[model samples]
Target chain A: MLRDITIGQYFPGQSPIHKMDPRMKIIATLLYIVMLFVASHPLSLIVGIAMLVLMYRVSGIPMKMITKSLKPVVPIIIFTSVLNIFFVSGDPLFQFGFIEITRQGLMLAILMSVRILCLIAGSSLLTYTTSPIELTDAIEILLNPLKKVKVPVHELSMMMTIALRFIPTLIEETDKIMNAQKARGADMESGGLMQRAKALVPILVPLFVSSFRRADELAMAMECRCYRGGDGRTRMKQLHYSHRDWIALCIMLVSIAAVLLLNRILA
Target chain B: MAVIKTENLSHVYSEGTPFVKTAIDNISIEIEEGQMIGVIGHTGSGKSTLIQHFNGLLQPTSGKIYIDGEDMWADKSKLRDIRFKVGLVFQYPEYQLFEETCYKDIAFGPKNMGLDEGEIDRRVREAAAFVSLSEEQLMKSPFELSGGQKRRVAIAGVLAMKPKVLILDEPTAGLDPKGRDRILGQIKEYHQEEKNTVLIVSHSMEDVAKFAQKVLVMNRSKVFLYDSVENVFARAGELSQIGLAVPQITQVFMELKKRGYPVNSNVYTIEAAKKEMIRLLEKGGEVRA
Candidate 1:
């Protein structure tokens, strides 16, 4: 049942979005998130949503997957919208005991939810299009300037790549261990919260032990391969910005400017 | 009566997701009581997925699994009871060990069954003995033991539960030849002593050939063949077509038979091959260096 997590998952495709430079995708995602916040008016939000739909069409990623990514953040979305309803006071629309719902408050709540949803959807597109390894490489390259101050960019990226690679492995291991424990009559289900937490001791202890073992073995393997991080290292698949990437970056900047313009004109 | 039975059992992993895969498809099998069955398949042929269903570790996407004539999922609340009735030792089980000492690790299963302290202790020691774990070793942390010893402790943990049917998925995997033999020997002994159903999933044809009386060959998430060892090995050509082979010794015998030798191609184990050679020799067959 734990296998449902799709966070940080990439879907392989031959679409333009998938083939875009990871650095460009990351920057575009950040800009998209900024646009969501800048988009205050309903027309701006509509533009934002239309842009997302266009990107989804161009990327060839299923709409279902985009919505599925927003599932985990539903609670946060609700909490923020509820908070905005009570906190953002203006001309009252309705009133209850010690509580007032204003027209501005209601609009703020809707806009806030739209902003958060667009933020998540925009960020998730980056992950969906870029492989974890590519993302790590992009991060390392983007942070290369920090290396002048001895930031250990290569080591950080290597750690990230390794962690990403082991996630599925560790998840598979956990599933195996859980099944083994369950077969021995470990009552993981049908238990109180405390009992369930205690039941996890059997799973967590083994997972931790195996994770350490894997880390040790990985270090040894890296050493055997004569890996000396950052110094005189080269990549096989060099990151290069194509015409498509430049076009994508241009589109993102234009949309962000348009959102800001709409916010000024409408608000 | 069948101790465990499945009718049209099918399981689709990550259903409705992009990663949707039918792990096992419409599998139906009846495992009689006290039968020693070996399940053979290529990797990702749903061997692990199939055994996980026996203990209710996985619920089938469709169809039913019956344990002792009761539908396993009929009363979802009783699934835990079904697990105790059919124990499964997973591949690389040593990694599942987590207790402070080997004793506690072995006792984990019985304790989970909610057995009394005295019974749990007795079963733990008996299981330790069955796996030939020394008394001195039981007190030490499971982390302190060698890889093979850790595997034994893990197996003993399941054995401590004393399930009516025991299923092991690649139990001898990643062990040296001697260590592998020791484990297979102990499992054989356990099956004999307990006279309960034992199902072993293995890639090693020889290991399965040596222990299992009945063989179930799976290919592409479906049962390819289910028959006696001799009958299954006799169709080595069909098995090889599906990326599985008969035992190495059986292959040698089959090769000899093809070369016009009077040898039994159905012999799966070295001992059986030896007896066949002896019979040929007694019948005045010429011996060649």
Candidate 2:
């Protein structure tokens, strides 16, 4: 079950979005998130939703995967929408004994839910296209300017890369430790909150011990291969800005502009 | 009576994913009570998956696993009791040790059974003795122990549970020949004293041949052979096809047979090979003549 819970899972593809530079993808996702918050008008929201759908189509990720990613947020979406529907003050569309459903409340709730959906889908699109290695490479390059201020950008990205690489291995080790403890009759699934937290001690202690051991081994291995931090290090696969990346960034900028213009016009 | 029985058991890992794999496939077998059975297979041949099902650690994908004539998954809540009845020592079990002292670590299983303090202490001491861990050693941190000692402490933790069926995955892995023999000898002694069904999953043909009364050979997620040690080793050629081979002595006997010597190819252990050699020498010493 732990293995099934994919985090920022990548789905490989040969589409333009998949081939786009990770830096552009990261920037576009951030800009898209900002545009979602800025655009309150219904027309602008529609433009945002259309853009997300078009991007998904281009990325070629299955519709099922989009729904799968959204499944976990369904509860949050429902809770927020229900709260907005009841709390917003406006002309009452329906009234039932102190429970009033106003027109503005209904409209706001619908737009808010749609905006949340688009926000999740848009960001997930970036992770689904780019691999973790590429994402970290993009981050290091994007933060290269920060090196002038002694930010240790390369070290930070190296840490990120190592962290991401060890995530799956640690998860697997956790699973093995859990099963080993479970075989010893450690009840993990059922109990009070305190009892359950207590049950995690057996799993966590061994996991931490093994993680430290692995980290030590890895450090020694890197040293054996002449690794000395990120200084004077060269990458085997260099990041480059292709025509596709520029075109994608241009489209993202134009879409943000269109959303802003529509917001002002509708207002 | 069958202590562990599986009917059409199959386990699929990452099912419904693109990387789906059938770890074990349609394995139907029955193990009698009080038998020391050795499960041998190449890596990824499903030996570990099959043993996990015996203790109810893993639910079968499409078949039934019956422990002591009862369907293990028939009552979900009762699986805990089933786990106590079947102790599983996972591969590299030393890495699972986390307690402050070896005594506390060995007592972990019996403590989980809600036993009285006196009973837990007794079982812990008994288990420590079974693994030949000293009284002073029990007071030391398991982390401070040597690799082989830590492995024994982990094994003792499971032994303290005193399950009706004991399953160990690669129990002697990553140990010296003497350490390996000591551990397996202790396990054999434990089996003899308790008369409990024991399943040892290993890669070493010689170790299995030396201790196990029966051998369960797995190949490509299926049961290749489930027979006595002699019968299984008799088909060394088929075993090699699955990336497994008989013991070195058995291979030597097979080679002798190939070169027109009348030695038995079923010689799996050194003692058996020695006896065969003696018989060949007593037959008028043809090469000497």
Candidate 3:
């Protein structure tokens, strides 16, 4: 049942996007996100969507996987669209007493839904292409300048990496504890709200106990490795931008320009 | 008659995910009544996954699991009834104990079955006695007991259900030598007294060899071998290949058998090996444990 929760599952590949320096990839992902709201017209949103699809393909990750990753967000996507359809104001194209459906409201709802979909799908491409290890490395590099302002960048990134690593381990432990409780005749499924909440105590207690044990072991292991922040520690895989990275950046810049130009022309 | 049987059973995980796996694939095994079955496999070899299916804790992704020759999942409404008949004591039994008092915790399963107060009390006391827990221990908080005592209380919780086929996933794990022996001895005695099917899922070759009449070896989610203890130990070398082995005494006797001695290679216990060696040496100078 927990197999549905997909986080930090690296898609194995050797595509150009995957090969791009993690730093460039991080920047590109941010810039791509910025471009999502750069235009209001349907034509420009189409361009943004097409760009995301192109990036998704270049990431060498399967389209099916991208949708699979979006599954947990499906309810949220539907919720937001429903909310916007009701609240977004314009001339009422269809009126029924207290309810009104307008042309602009309907179009805005569609575009907003697509925007949310593309935003999730596009960024998931970044995570799909770059492993969590590389993503944290890129974050540390980007945050290095803030170290002058006393922002414990290394410690923050280290914490992020550790959390990322333990996500699956914790989930597995949860599954084990859940099954153990299930064996004890703990009725988890058929119950009222209070009964269901009470049933989870057996699972949660064990999970919490094991998680602390694992954390204690991990801290000791890290201390054994002489890990005291990112001080003078070099990484095995260095981040370096190539000519192709520069070309990719320029292409993204051109796309933003096209969206802006289209926005102005349409306005 | 077999208490539990699987017909071409399989469990495929993460069906469409990139990291999909088939934990138990096309496994068909019959577990007869009153037999101590030792299912051994390395970690992640579907040992846990396979056992969870015994009581319908897991619905098979494919095929069927029959409990007492009845389809376990045929009536989804009464699957919990199947659990009462196939008691699964998980690896860390202590984690399942949540009631304020040990008595209430032990009574949980029988209570879930809607048994009467008299029946629950009788089952709880009998199960507690089987685990060598005293009457005083039942009233105390289970969380207050020593780890071994806590483990015993958790185990009795399942035993109170009086399952026809008791499945323990590493019942003696984390116990000291004495604790391990005491617990296993109790389980064996329970099996003798009740004549119920006992399946102990463990990685310890010694424990299985010392007790179980049958051995079921699993490697990479598939049945590597399954047979009577003596028949399986005769192929000790193949067992070692999959990170398993015959009992130490059997290993030595098998070696002696290889060296043209009259030692019995099927001897799985030190006492049996010692007796065989004594008889063989009296006949000639022959065997040893």
Candidate 4:
């Protein structure tokens, strides 16, 4: 059940988005987020939505996956929307006993919900098209400036890479331990929160034990291969920008321009 | 009646995604009570998925599971009860430990079962004993134990619940020869004491040969073969065709038989192979005694 988590999970593909340089994709993602802040009017929102739809098409990542990634955040979106709608005092459109829906409040709710949804979808698109390793590579390059300030850029990236690499491995290990415990008749379901959580110990204990063992072995193996804190280390796959990256950059720039104009005109 | 059974069971990971996968297709099998069943398959052959469904860890995409002829999912509210009846000890189970002490960790499952304190203590002590863990060891944090000790504690955690039909997915994986034997030995002891339907999902033909009386071979998300150890191992070539090899000693014995040696080709365990070799030697074979 724990393995079903799809948040930030990459869907490998050979689409245009997948082929674009990770550094550029990373930058495009940030620029897109920056643009979203200024997209207040419905027209800019429509354009932003259109761009996301177009990007989704080009990326070939199935729409179902983006929807899957949003499952856990449903409550968060609802909570934010409710808070925005009820607490934001304005001219009431309808009044009932203790509840009232206001015009400005409704718009705020819609906008906040849409913004949260779009943010999640857009960020998910980055992971959906790019593998974790590629993202880490992009991050390491993007954060390379922090090295002079002793920010441990290499260590951070290496840690992120290792962590990302282990997600699936850990999930697989969890499956194994769960199976092992289930065979022993360890009840995990149909419990109160405490019971359910307690039931996880059978699964978690062995998982942690094996994970630490795997880490030890992995560290030894890395040391054997001369993995000394990533200092002076190089990658087998180098990141490079192509014409497609330029196109992506241009697309991001257009979105930014549209967001600015819409905010100016709407205001 | 089958102790555990699946009807047209299928599991599809990421069902509607581009990375969707049908890990286990419409596969069905019935496990009898008190049977030591060995599940052998190549990697990604749905061995893990198949075992997960035995208990309620996984629900089939489009099928039903009957635990002792009762629909496991029918009482969804009591799913943990089903989990208790059909225990599963997953692969690399040693990592699941997070409790402060080994005793608390082993008692974790029983506590979840809502057993009384005295009962939980009884189960915990029994489980620890079954896994050969000592009193002194139980007081220490599970994190402080050795790798094998931690693994035993993890297994004990589940065994403490006393599920009727136990399933272990590669219980002896990644261990050295001695550690492997010790783990396997404990599992055997557990099965003997519990007398539950034991299903071992493993790729180790050697362990299966020595431990399991019945073998179930899975290939391409299907049940390729299921029979007594002798019957299944006899069709070693079919297992090989599906990327699974029979026990090495059994393979060696078969090779000898194929070369016109007047030896029986049914040896699985080392002791059996040794006995068969001694028998052949007594019969005055031209080969060295």
| Global lDDT scores for all candidate models | 0.90, 0.91, 0.86, 0.84
Supply candidate 3's per-residue lDDT for A231: 81
**Clash number by candidate, in order:** 0, 0, 0, 40
Clashing pairs in 3: none
Q: Is candidate 3 or 4 superior in TM-score?
A: 3
Residue pairs in clash, model 2: none
lDDT tens per residue, model 4, B1-289: 9998889989998766566789888877888889898999888999988888877778889889998899988997767678788777877777667778999878878876889999999999999999899999999998788888988998898889888888888888888999999989999988987888889988789999999999998888888998999999999887888778888998898889888887888999999998998888887847542
Worst 10 residues of 1 chain B by lDDT: B280-289
In terms of lDDT, the poorest run of 10 residues in model 1 chain A is: A182-191
Candidate 3, after superposition: displacement of residue A228 in Å?
3.3
TM-score of each: 0.97, 0.95, 0.92, 0.84
Model 3, chain A: how large is the TM-score? 0.93
Compute DockQ for each candidate against the true complex. Answer: 0.83, 0.79, 0.52, 0.42
Which of the predicted structures, 2 or 4, would earn the higher DockQ when compared with the native? 2
Tell me the chain A TM-score of model 4. Answer: 0.95
DockQ of 3: 0.52
Off by over 4 Å in 2: A257-267, B287-289
Which scores greater on lDDT, model 1 or model 4?
Answer: 1
lDDT of 2 by residue, A207-235 (tens): 98998999999999999999987888888
Write one digit per residue (lDDT tens) for candidate 4, span A1-267: 666788878777899899999999989988888777678865677767787788898988777766777777899989988887887889998888888889888888887777777788999999988899989999999999998898989889889999999999988777666655554445665669998997776666657667787899999999899878867787899888999999889988987898888878886
The regions of model 3 sitting more than 4 angstroms off are: A86-92, A96-99, B99-101, B135-146, B241-243, B284-289
Question: Model 3 lDDT vs. the true structure?
Answer: 0.86
